[model samples]
Structure formats: structure tokens, C-alpha cells
Target: MRHGPATRRGRPAVSGRIVLRLDRMMVERGRSLGWLARQVGITDANLSKIKNNHVSAIRFSTLAAICEALDCQPGDVLVYEADDGDDGTGPRP
Candidate 1:
């Protein structure tokens, strides 16, 4: 359970968190948003939510589709960012 922001990464007392790197990968692949959405079988708007980091969850199937379309591994798309409270270690993107 979350007591407050202390256990969260919203504002103050930030901590490690998962991040999505779909935007950069898409750019490098020269793929358009609409094209990717079509390839992944998701709506452009929904994919936009994921791109902007507004969504909370994504299906493994969707992730696989994205990876296949981009020819990248999951690590190349998702990232883990650790705040100062962590062991001062951060996961590479």
C-alpha cells in the first residue's frame, strides 16, 4: 500500500520508476505513429497515451508487437529510472 508521495514518484520524495522509450525508438526506425498503431493493432490515440507516458499498463502482446515492428528488444523500449533514494544505481537505457 502507498502511504503518500513518499512511496510514490509523483512530486516530492521521488523514487525509482519504469519508463517507456517508444518515442526515440520510433524516431530511429523512421516509423510514423499511425503506422506503428496499425502494426500493433492499437488505436493511434491509445498508442499516443503510451508514448506520452500517461498510461499505467501495457499488455505483453502489445509489447511484443512493438518490439517486432521496431526490431528491438524489450530493454530498448522500457527503462527503469532510480532516484537518489535508491542505491545510487540507475539502469541503462
Candidate 2:
């Protein structure tokens, strides 16, 4: 049977990647978006958007306030993952 879309049979592609562990970080810090919003005086919805990585841009002051309140560095909020293309088996690579 024909499998799903073939991936050029071994060719690899490079793409920029972004990793977000904000949810985990918030849990570890014993803080919620609401609390953070109150602390930073930003809307909870805004914080949620950032937590879900749906935010397109964020002000430096807001980021700085979050970092200060959470006592964590930017690295803790964002992670980097290399782009490894599918090996033609499945999406998991």
C-alpha cells in the first residue's frame, strides 16, 4: 500500500525552531498567570498568550518584570531545539 506523503527519500531540510517551557516554569515557581499578571500589571490573557507561544511580540519591560518576579532567566522560559527532518518512517525523528 502507498504510504503517506514521501519526504524526498532522505533529503533533510533546515528550519528555525523555538521551544517554550513556560507552563512548566510557572508551575515550578508556584505561580499562575493571574498572579503574574497582577505582579507585572499585565493582562492575564496577554500572559496566557505568551505561555502558549501565541504571542507575536512582547515588550522588554514586560519580559523583564516577568523574569524578575519568577526569579528565572530568559533561557528558562525559552528553549532551543535543532531541526531534524523526518527519516521517512514517521513524523517522530
Task: TM-score each candidate.
Answer: 0.74, 0.67
CA lDDT, candidate 1, residue 17: 73
Root-mean-square deviation per candidate = 5.9, 9.1
Best candidate, TM-score-wise?
Answer: 1
TM-score of candidate 1 on Cα atoms, chains taken together = 0.74
Tens digit per residue, CA lDDT, model 2, 39-72: 8888888888888989766677887888899999
Q: After superposition, how far is residue 91 of candidate 1 from its true place, in Å?
A: 8.5
Residues 1-87, model 1: lDDT tens digits: 555666345556646777888999999999999999999999999999999889888899999999999999998988876764443
- How well does model 1 score by local distance difference test? 0.86
Q: Model 2: how far is 33 from its true place, Å?
A: 1.3
The residue pairs found clashing in candidate 2 are none
Clash pairs, model 1 backbone = none
**Would you list the C-alpha lDDT of every candidate in the order shown?**
0.86, 0.75
